[model samples]
Target: MKIFNRVAAAIAAVACLSVGGAIAQSQAPLVVGSTLSLTGPLSATAMTHKLVGEIYVDQLNARGGLLGRKVEWLVKDDQSKPDLARTLYEQLITSDKVDLLIGPYGTGTILSAMGVAQRYNKVIVNHTLGIPSLSKYEMAFPSWSLGSDPGNTVPNTVFDAVAASPKPPKTVAIVTSKFPSIHFMSLGAREVAKKRGLQEVLFLEWDFGNRDFGPIAARIKDAKPDMIWVGDIALEGNMLLDAMKKIDYVPPIHFHTYPAPGPMSKSPDGNLALSMSIFEEHAPFTNNKVATDFIQIYHERTTKANMPDIAVEVQAAASYAAWQILEAGVRGANSFDDKAIAAWIRKNRVNTIYGQVRFDGPGNFGDDMMKVKQVQNGKWQMVWPTQFAAPGAKLQVR
Candidate 1:
């Protein structure tokens, strides 16, 4: 009986040892919280971001994740509403207890979420929306703005486009949504136009969430400006196009804030002749190695061959780059504390699809590397910066 008791004790000890070893091999999963506009006006654009996040997390997990732990993403839909975005952000931080927070789809959404992040002292890596005012917010908290600042770059890009035009537009008509974010974009463009000796004809503003753009389109047609600039989100894109078609008003040159569906062949009219501030970090035209790899992996996972839209490509690359930055900081500090990670990210320069990304004192990647793209023969081509241009852009005369 004593021999049997000894044997049983030895077996139990061995079993416990094996269990402990298994636990040691498998690290705890890192939790990341994401707020997205999955089911509202911006659903299409938001879905692109969600897919990119999923692809990134999946690839990271396949490669043993960060710090030998798998990355588990917790995504919440904000319905493209700022109030809901704030609520979701609070839930993510307090209840989900996420390790990090990522900005949502639009500037307004990001602004709302930032309040929650600040209150909780969470580490936020923003990729989607950029407001010049973000510098002020970053100064107050641990946050990084990974996207281009529209207030600064949009005006510059607009001026550059006008100066390069064969016959610089003298009269310009601008239309924007009432949303503060969209209004700011339009304001930037207007300032640039005014600086370039362009006469402002009609500065029309309409409700963003409303469907009818007919009244605004009528006013734009009456202005009969040499150039028309559309500063609104994707939802507004469709409405504006439809309204323009009704009026039979086509300006000599049309500049869009976001990548126009018509330029990408998504819109049948194909009226999107010129685009400014269109994020193309992952487009094959750029010949970026990192971008190519990301696209290939994204397609492989989804089994879909379509190239990702501009926003999705940029957001995904930026978000993944943010993760790489965070990983470096965590490894450098040997801790996941928000302040440590923020300090590390601010000091280190990380590589991304958009090239070397390092925040300035205000937590902004202050590189003025905006590219100009135009639609010719139904294909969007990069035609600026001399290095990326394919036989310079030819202006289509009206």
Candidate 2:
């Protein structure tokens, strides 16, 4: 009788240990992968993205992570090269066996790496990089592709601003890099300009890696446009401004696809304070509690003295939002199978820092929420949406 009782107690102890081990395995960390351009022409923007991603992962881990599993982000520098991005993505999917994939800053990189993502059947939660065709692909694959479509958001903002302008420019000059990302931006911007009754005087494309804009400057001077639209990355955008100053070709309105007002606003000539598009999804100047909280956290982590500029702020928020959506989908599906999570993300409306987030049937995050922000008195002020307008934005001419 005594031997039997001892045997029963040992069996109970073994069962409890087995259950605890299973629980620990279930709560193990999930690994995620990223390919970013950390050392090339787009390095500055990529660095900002990296900082934001790091901060977000840190914060998420601090909060006990998502779905009972801490996230481990494995980031690789692609140096802004599409081929390198593809290689890194291949390695992450095969060797690292990452559970999720996110980022490849520019459109060209994203498009190139996406082929590998398709082959591996991985879920891609893009942070930035706007390729219009991605929407079409998502419709066919259903469980393969996903991301925000900046192409629609940017053009809509530009056209709306022009349509409402008190004295809209009659002639416009569109300048963009030949990179795949800016190509779409230029296409969208030109379409918007034409629809708004603005004549496109000069449509110029330059290689992003090229440092000299002298010829472009001369061409802009010759075109004598009433407005200038820039479709380049932040660094190239800054160089263009410098060239504009040197040429003294000041158009009535200077619009940029993204908010690059940081370097431009701080320029000795202050050439960037003209007109720009602040995607409502990425606008940091809003009174939204999420925006405020993100800004505070970003400032605390980075070396920047002031709050992160609009681009950095947007990148961080968007990256964090993507992570949250990824988590939601993972939890809702109750499985890490890429196909299941992708389907879940497509069907469900995710509440994120940005706002109520839901992808269209094609897996494209639609554009009803983009805010158009303008610079006034050396500050970025929300000019559209009326609900979040800054004090000086109300008086400024569109």
Candidate 3:
């Protein structure tokens, strides 16, 4: 009789534990919070990040979510304002009590998000953070993979590609926005151009949100450099190209820092433009089933959303990879504890659409995996390196 009673007690305890675990799993969804420039100058690029985040969250929930709990993405708009981003991040962490954080788009905004995440000791996975030197937080991981010194390495890559061109530019025009990251990289490019012995005939900077590019375009035309590096973000590239077209100036070669992908391809003046790319919808990049499926879904959804560009390019890939990093950290740690998740990410490599990514370097950065892409026909195609180039596509210069 005594033995029977002890056995029964043991069974009851096991049952209670099982029920408790089930209840916890079935409770409210695990919330992931972030901000985007949803309705401001950055909106053109932010839309891609927004769509990618939506797709990732939906897919995560479909897969039973993180830690067997349904996931909810709570995204707020920062209106392309860094100050507002800082405030919103605070609200997301404190008021909403989000379980996890994904970084907002743009360098300044991501920096703001990082500050809040650090204060709360929460882990953050970010994509498209251009200025790595500013990423001093230990909990912040970067998925953009532009290396430790992108300002230096990225310009070297650009210069190397142009040097290999049939008609390398003897003179260069460097124009940039006063936006934080763009300005930083442009300054680096200026030094790089001088080091490479390319004469710098023109250098200009404009306020970030300035709508008028007519004066800048006129100045660029007067310089008449062989190649022009336009440090543009969002719709700035299109605006500058329009201004140049109005003045009957056609640049022999133009490189944009980060342009609105869809609008650029659609612009008459934007044909043959070059830019940095981490991934594009192509054979080598889509060779795996995961990337191929993502491309297809992005196509269907972006079309439904009426996005200007419905193709999976660098911005889309980087955003998707950010979610991948966050998910991998969560699953590897098997806990929502921010410290545990950050530790796991620092210790492990996450295979993403941009290839295997690790966050153990300075500023939680990894290898530089960026490629040079050109607008060919109506598509952005990788063309710099021999292997990653789109089918039968190589650098075209005249």
Best by lDDT: 3
Which residue ranges in model 2 land beyond 4 Å of their true spot?
1-24, 135-153, 259-261, 268-288, 304-312, 394-398
Worst 10 residues of 2 by lDDT: 138-147
RMSD, candidate 1, Å: 3.8
lDDT of 1 by residue, 140-195 (tens): 22222323466656666655655676777788888887666668878878887777
The CA lDDT at 203 in model 2 is 96
* Residue-level lDDT tens digits of model 3 in 1-398: 99999999999999999999989767769999999999999999998999999999999998988888899999999999999999999999989999899999999999988998999899999878999989999999998999889989999999888888889899999999999999999999999999999999999999999999999999999998999999999999999999999999988989999999999977767889999999998979989998988998999999999977788999999999999999999999999999999999999999999799878889989898888999988899998876999999988774
Where does candidate 3 stray beyond 4 Å?
A: 1-26
In order, the Cα lDDT scores of the candidates are: 0.66, 0.67, 0.92
Total clashes for model 1: 0
Candidate 2: tens digits of C-alpha lDDT, residues 80-172: 888999999999989998888875677777776777887777877766556655534441121112235555556666656655667667888
TM-score of each: 0.85, 0.84, 0.94
Candidate 1: list runs displaced more than 4 Å.
1-26, 139-149, 259-265, 277-288, 300-324, 331-334, 363-365, 390-397
User: 1 or 2: which has the higher TM-score?
Assistant: 1
Greater-lDDT candidate between 1 and 3: 3
Model 1 / residue 308 / CA error / Å:
8.9
